[model samples]
Target: MPAVTVDSTLELPRVPVPPAEGTRQRPVLSVTTAPRGFEGEGFPVHRAFAGVAQRDLDPFIHMDQMGEVEYAPGEPKGTPWHPHRGFETVTYMIDGEFEHADSHGGGGRITDGATQWMTAGSGILHIETPPEHLVLSGGLFHGIQLWVNLPRANKWNPPRYQSIEGGQATLLSSPDGGALVRLIAGDVAGHRGPGSTFTPITMIHATLRPGAQLVLPWRADFNALVYSLSGRGSVGEQGRPMEASQLAVLGGGDALSVAASARPDERTPDFDVLILGGRPIREPVAHYGPFVMNTREELVQAFEDFQAGKMGAIPAGKMPHTAPGEQRPV
Candidate 1:
């Protein structure tokens, strides 16, 4: 398959979710930042990572509540370059634009609403810089960069990628209102997320219409979280509304369900939510920076191998040296 690039006029899909049955429980919205040690623009993320869903939310590790940011020209930050290992870094662009190049001979640019799914198997070195059109010209640079862990068995397979641009993504309408829902991955309303997934996970992008009631199922066995991108709505049946920048938590059961209704008098426009959850991985997780391993011994060997040039050497001047794999010849 070929790489999918994004254009300025591309429109992202807006699919609406339907109201589910049952007197479900409400979700607990919590504010979380990255752990104390790591320091970067990506720290102190708005929600959970290695917290309540650490081992429970397998496949998915954490989501970096990325930008809806409007950066000034030459501001402190516009775009960024980073490295990764043992997982997949998926970027869902909503506004602005982003261009990236990696050691795997993969490079491309995608604008708002495109999904970039990159799997850093053994290791990978890459730089992601935002498009000057949006950054320099002063527009919104909005999106989410989610971290999905590779299962113990699939971790070292190979570094690869697949992406779905603004086109090809499905757009479904709310059964009643003008609201919409978009599927970045997994199946909803009979339309499976575009492209293929290495794991059985589902990610839905949804909006709430006034007084709209929506109830959805949760895999009791899988851990899940509903992230409020913009708007107000209470999760589950617990009874309380979660505003912007908060994440609501729901535990695993034989199955799970969420019920919510939009507040009519609320000034918020359509309440946007990025619903993410997945099956749990009960295996041991030895994580350090970008690499995640099953055993401490394996983790130790990985470090030694990286230092001795086993995976591969890092490019000339990158700090910390996270990548340890051969780059495809350009």
Candidate 2:
């Protein structure tokens, strides 16, 4: 995988990974895309729809922005079928709808500005596509897809879904400049979001008015990173602009500090930030395709089970309840 450039103007900032010699300040790693996602194109990848990795910034492995731009009808717009395991996949949309189905017995459609949280526990097979709603409108389709790893104890637990409608997400006013903040998983300042979580996690959405500097709190031991969806601000005395479709891999803070506010009487530019952080898994991360486990034996078991045509990703002997009439002949 080649390193995806965030911007030459933005300097790199890095904190030491665990078990290193000592506390150290390293240069920031540039953003990069996965090899397969390149569509066989050569290096120096283009930035049409790139997913930045917070893996180095925090502990996040992959963060892909699916729809920053709109799509027209019959324009070949959709994410072809794919697979996932070992980590939790989170899909959040702002403008257009996304269609999804999986070999794991979970399938549904999400309208624009909606979010779907899928935990690919054990071994699950899945795919995602754009909904027909956008086909009719021929308007824009945009959304975000993120991958979060599970702790060693819970990696093979079971796959589950938590869908949050655009209206269901909790929105609150910030302590300063009246910025709007939406909590998706954890609490911020005093505002709590409505999304369910299987791990100790914090995911929030924030919008800053021009010249407004808003600061958000985070844990020191836990890893956290901010994906700039839109707008500009100084990240703790360092002037960094969080523009639409770009990301700001942050550094320097026991508590994550960021500022996005309206300029003195100046019209506020659109600014959106996704602040995600959680307890880092100190264990080794063995990722192959989608299944994340501790060792190669576990990864091989996952593949063998998939080849045997196992329907769901949940562990054996534990089947979560499904809606009536959902059970069908195998």
Clash totals in order: 21, 19
Q: How much is the lDDT of residue 214 in candidate 2?
A: 52
Model 2: per-residue Cα lDDT over 167-282, one tens digit each? 67666554443356666777665556677766667887766666655555555555656666655554443455444445545453455555664542232264566777776666
Candidate 2: stretches off by over 4 Å: 1-59, 261-268, 311-330
> What lDDT is reached at residue 102 by model 1?
66
Give per-residue CA lDDT, model 1, range 1-330, as digits (tens): 011222311253323343454424434545333332222433222433535556445667766665555666653232233446677878787666777666566657867678888888776656666555654566566677788877788878788888788666665544454445566777654577785667677887766565654455445545677777766666665655666666666654332323335453364555677788666666778777656778888777666655554554444543222333432210
What stretches of model 1 exceed 4 Å from their correct place? 1-53, 76-81, 218-221, 253-268, 304-330
Model 2 lDDT on a 0 to 1 scale: 0.56
Question: Model 1 TM-score?
Answer: 0.77
User: What TM value does model 2 have?
Assistant: 0.72
Q: In lDDT terms, which candidate is top? A: 1
TM-score of each: 0.77, 0.72
Q: Where's the lowest-lDDT run of ten residues in candidate 1?
A: 1-10
